[model samples]
Target: MSTPPESRQEAIARLSRSASDLEARTTRQLSHEAAGQKAAGQAWKIIADLFGGVFVGLALGFGIDYFAGTTPVGIIGGVLLGFAVSVWMAWRTAQRLMAEAKQHGEPQSVPFDDDEDQGA
Candidate 1:
């Protein structure tokens, strides 16, 4: 003679299955979120490396020149090179951002298309 599912043992077994299912689902979601975060971190790391290289180059050059007592030649040349590299990096970053925005089906980015007619 078996008791109905309303009995305590049957209800407990159902609850256990549900709990396990929920745990599996939660684990999958967390792993996906972690992967996304890691990818974003990698992207930021690339950009940071570019900027950090420029910063280090300028700082080291200026510091060396200051210690060496060579006024404008070393320091200014380092600064000019760093500035040029940074500007180029910024332009590339802007272009990438614009392309990403476009990929998302976003509105037209005006500055990216200078040939567009702006009747304002």
Candidate 2:
């Protein structure tokens, strides 16, 4: 047998609850997506910094080689210097990012436990 119909007020209350739940779920999903986008943007910035460093070095080295007639040495030195600078810059950026993340109370990756590995 079918149950009795709900009252108009009960129906309205049920709809309101459903709407609230939907709103909450939508808000959570949007926030998660925004966070992912932010992370992706930061990653791209890091990659761009790395490539820009290398490109700048290469260009400077090529210019020096063209003018000074020290072809191989200039290019090689420039590339090495550029790579070193890029690495240092990347390290600094990573440190800053880590600090910001810590300050914001973001969840960090769990450190590897050697004990667990040894047991296996």
Q: Point to the candidate with the largest lDDT.
A: 2
* Global lDDT scores for all candidate models: 0.71, 0.83
Error of 1 at 58 (Å): 0.5
Best by TM-score: 2
TM-score of 2: 0.81
Clashing pairs in 1: none
Local accuracy of candidate 2 as per-residue lDDT tens digits, 2-120: 99999999999999999998898677667767878998998888888788888888888999999999999888888888888888888888898899998989564433457436755
Q: Any residue pairs clashing in model 2, and if so which?
A: none
Please give the RMSD to the true structure for each candidate, in Å. Answer: 13.7, 8.3
On the 0 to 100 scale, the lDDT of residue 72 in model 1 is 70
> Candidate 1 on 36-112: residue-level lDDT in tens?
79658767855775677577667867887889988677767776777677667767876776687678684432232
